[model samples]
Target: MRKDVVPVSSPSPLPPLSPPAGPPPCPPARRVSLPAARPVRLVLCLSPVLLAGCWALADRPVASEGASRLAAADPGWLLAGAALTCLTWVAAACVRQGSLPDKLPPGLLLASQFAAGAANHVLPGGLGAHAVTLRFLRARGVPLDRATASIGLYSLARSVTRTLVLLAFLAACPARRRLGELVPDGPVPVPAAAVAGGALAVAGVLLTVVPPVRRPVTGLVRAALADARAVHGRPCRVLALWGGSAAMPLVQAGTLVCVGTSLGLGLPWEQVVLAHLAAGTAVGAVPAPGGLAVDAALVWTLVSFGAVPAVAAATVIGHRVLNDWLPLLPGALTLSALIRARAL
Candidate 1:
């Protein structure tokens, strides 16, 4: 008995699955938690403050004395010294630009130098400043070799100029006789020179023995020579290099002179200049950072020149405040800003 089977149509085949309307929803964006990122940024932001604070606290007594003396100093002369201090950075920028054949943005170059001054005080042997400059050059697309060569040239020119300046002042200074008294009657200088020569010789031998070291050093020498030739060929660059270098010591002396005058330090401006130049030259070979050794030498020299001990101390302190301490915070801020902008 065939049951009246109603024509049972097979269930309509399901419509073919169509692809979801858009590209497969990207796997829920991975939530990457950088636990250290915030802390890194915080550290970077606070580094300058911490450094300045620690430096100030390290010499709290000296800093306090300097601050009090500066407060008592002639504001007009202090202002002049401050102005001269600013010019030193300008001179530095010119020297840096003249060292390289390529042109750096004047504003940024000046800014970098301003920032470098702050860094110079923090690290030994000017490492901090050099590091900042190297980073700046790299960011500006300068070749590493050329950048390094420029630094070497800058240092060499500055040293030569400083020596020439010291000699010139010595020849012209009326206090030359007094300065001669400061030199020890011994073979001290001879040994120092011999040691320096031996160090160079040992370094040369090591470079010669190590292929890897030799190659890079040789390349650097070649690059330096080429850059020097290129830079010297241009009259403006030559003037800027030598002239700016020479100006550095002169301006620094001027700053000291102004500060000394402001604080009633009993010394002629010329004597002060001579003292500063001589003291710096004498102690420059010392590796103490931030010219600490030079500062001590300067204080001693000033005393020898018949300045009152307290006044001489105050003078040096004021000079340091005008040159180093005053600009530190601003320079640090500039440095931080540059880092943020990726210009350093």
Candidate 2:
């Protein structure tokens, strides 16, 4: 009846209907890219800063004398430094093997160490070397937990020994005692003991809070206690291995002192120990490859605090040339050989 009353207007043109809107869509998640290796670029960025720092510190008249002293350093000292590095490797292997099974073999340990050292020098934070060591041990059928425990134990043993040496030196020296007082109740009186206690406390906290660290810490504790038991049975081997590892840092400190002497700067043994330990620790914590720029700055700063700026600069410079760069050659060669031999 309605259709009869209305003119057929194309089915009365259906009223416009709006499509229902769904919930607003979320933004797509962004992806992050991994960092790329750029060794040459990193070196370029760091080298200029190192050179400038050295130059700025070398401005004093004392620099001339330091230059002369550097020229006259006994070649014997250089030989001794190299020997110390060798001893370090041997001690490292011994420590590694001590925590591992008897069937793992010493050769693999040494190869792993050499490879790791090379990686440390070339890569940031020496993580590359650490990774290599981890993978190598893993390939040898070492469980991750055991490998982690062994590495931690060896490192802890070395650090404890080195810290004790520095503490002894600090206690024996008056200048260091005075310097310690200057920093508003600083680590002045007993640097080593204080640092060790601090490290233990920090590690204890880390074990309690961090899941990754907890497992490793517990494993390490067990391994170390077991090692203590074994040492009680064969105290000689443990002592020799750890003792040798511990001595390596002393050799390093002695070398730094010799460098100071060669620069005609009578930096005390205590100060020298302070410089080496402080600088080495700081640099090792940095992410830079072998802490190139950071290490140089740290060494310069430590020595300068106790000596003429010129002498400090010269000492750092000469030490780098004599110690750091000199070792790089052999380390590089060893790395190449290991690579070619497929030992790494």
Query: Which predicted model would earn the best lDDT?
Result: 1
Q: Return the clash pairs for model 1, or none.
A: none
Which stretches in model 1 have alpha-carbon errors above 4 Å? 1-35
lDDT of each: 0.90, 0.62
Give me candidate 1's TM-score against the actual structure: 0.89
In model 2, the runs with Cα more than 4 Å from the true position are 1-74, 101-108, 181-233, 281-284, 292-305
RMSD to true structure for each model, in Å: 6.3, 12.9
Predicted model with the maximum TM-score: 1
What TM-score, over all chains together, does every model reach?
A: 0.89, 0.61
Candidate 1 residue lDDT tens string, 1-344: 88787887899889999887977766878889798897897678567667877887887787788999999889999999999999999999999999999989999999999999878778877777888899899999999999999999999999999999988888888788887778889889889899899999999898989899999999999999999999999999999999999999999999999999999997889999999999988887778767889889999999989999889989998888889887888988888888878897
The sequence of per-residue lDDT tens digits that candidate 2 reaches over residues 25-65 is: 88898886535545654554444334434543554343454
Native RMSD of candidate 1 (Å): 6.3
Q: Looking at model 2, how many pairs of residues clash?
A: 0
